[model samples]
Target: MSGETTNETWEEIVVRVLKANEVSLVTYVPDNVLSRLIRLIEADPFFTVVAPAREEEAVAIVTGAYMAGKRGIALMQTSGFATIVNALASLACPFQIPLLLMISERGTLGEFQQGQAIVCRTMRPVLQSLGIEHFAIQERAHVEFVVDGMVRQAFATQAPAALILSPLLTKRAA
Candidate 1:
């Protein structure tokens, strides 16, 4: 599929997936690719969106939300993933707190920033090193399948699962 037809707006897709999973809490650091999604969740009364002071803080908050019997997802950029590595390894790994992480895949094709490229190239290996389960969303057609499967698996395994969003799978607002 062409990029235009394949990359649906993030808000429409994410709202559907989250509602299907019955997720009630969302914690995230601001991400440009995910701004529309954040806004959608913010406007929904049934969902609670928490903007944490730091990436790790978002991890901790989601962990707590899970323990409180609320399903939660965290949104952040690839670099923010690096910042929360320690927390994912220490807290989420051992405690088996299932988290749906919506991550912007940086440093890939068409990326302008050098730093984003470096980290984007290495992000998967980093997640692998930490043993976190993850899936890349490269096209809109894969969003529902990837998101639903990962979310279910994360909760079933009681571990963190990630849906990595690449620019190829998204489009900038016109």
Candidate 2:
């Protein structure tokens, strides 16, 4: 299924794409922006959801899971993403682990928090500097395609890929 139905939410589409890609392990650091996605992933028996104390830990967990012959993903908000830069650069990238990351975009579109806004601007540049493949999903219509393709390419190339969930898609913009 392409998950093109109007009734299917972006969160549901994400779960479906993850399952279709055989990504059975879900690691995350709790965040309000990603709560719905995490809840859906946890409720599904197909996924083994792990909530770590920090985003960096989630990255390490997914990397370890991948080493054990499992496909995994790390979900977190933009602020949490700031904590994982070192882990992503030193561990995931150098080790060639296809650590999947799903980040909820914040600090944009009338954001109230100055800290979030600052980090948001640096996110894309950091990803580019590290040569990590990243895509932003601003609309539900393109979620499945971008997610599936990123998953496939990440594993195939043995490199990490990021999926940024834009507020426009989540309907949380300002």
Candidate 3:
């Protein structure tokens, strides 16, 4: 109770925080690691979930939704995050859209795919280069804090923010 989500799963905490923040639009490119989170968001009537063909398309969808006076979040895998750089740089950043990205971290220790690892390495650098605020949620206790704080910051400042869901947090590291 009172912002303490110690008993809930990370996905549940994410959905709770998102709802609490009034993020009504959920835009994402389907990702296996994020399936549970997406499903939870979809089941909730408060959210308008949209799956676009590509990660960049998801970003665009969120941007358009924000323009129309609705808050949105984009969910994707780390590799998919690599595909949205142009859209984020062009449409989201320059236009002052508060694009909230929830990326399922891939590539790194215990990872099997070389491409995922390659892209994972580049994600943080790209975010930093673009001056997009980002944070990784690796602990259950930290989930609500990071997600909620990032969401608040992005919308308050009209800037982009990312919440990277680490394999450790999702318990699907591979």
Candidate 4:
């Protein structure tokens, strides 16, 4: 595999792009696909990582961090996206807090769980309804450009944004 022409692993690219965008506070509810990025983010002294009991807490944590003049993001799975709607609507949106969401797309692309499927089906519409912008990342090539652009746009406009990490990108265990 040494001289392989394989796509870059999503976690490594995501972490590098995040650091370039100056992200400092990171919060997550924990997902298998996101674990690799979490470890990298935790290891960097520039970042402060928090594992909240729920997804909504991650949203709130980033919102506060944003107000305090820090760049922040939340990483979670599609299922956890279901739990953060209220927090995003009530806190993040109306207040215009800039947040970057890195979500591992579950329930689509060969998902085994019915719950994940339902959440996956609704995640985009939910984000749209909240006036949050989202972009899908299925190729490694799109990571740095799309993520960097979205994060810059989000903070510049002081609004929430999402980057949907497709199963094809994560290549994770179902």
Best by lDDT: 2
Q: By TM-score, how accurate is candidate 4?
A: 0.91
Give each model's whole-structure lDDT. 0.83, 0.90, 0.88, 0.84
Give lDDT tens digits, candidate 1, residues 1-174: 123434556567777778888888899998888888888889989798889789898888989989999999989999888788888888998888897788987777777999887877778887898798988887676777778789889988898988888787775333
Q: Worst 10-residue stretch by lDDT in candidate 1?
A: 1-10
Model 2: pairs clashing at backbone N, Cα or C within 3 Å: none
Kindly list the per-residue Cα lDDT of model 2 for residues 39-94, writing each as its tens digit: 89888999998887888889999999999999999999898888888998899999
Between candidates 1 and 4, the one scoring higher on lDDT is: 4
Give me the runs in candidate 2 sitting further than 4 Å from their true place. Answer: 172-174
**Any runs in candidate 3 off by more than 4 Å, and if so which?**
172-174
Q: What ordering of candidates by lDDT runs from best to worst?
A: 2, 3, 4, 1
Residue 28, candidate 3: how far off, in angstroms? 1.0
All-Cα superposition RMSD per candidate: 3.7, 1.7, 1.8, 3.7
Off by over 4 Å in 1: 1-8, 172-174
Task: Provide the global lDDT of candidate 2 against the true structure.
Answer: 0.90
TM-score of each: 0.90, 0.95, 0.95, 0.91
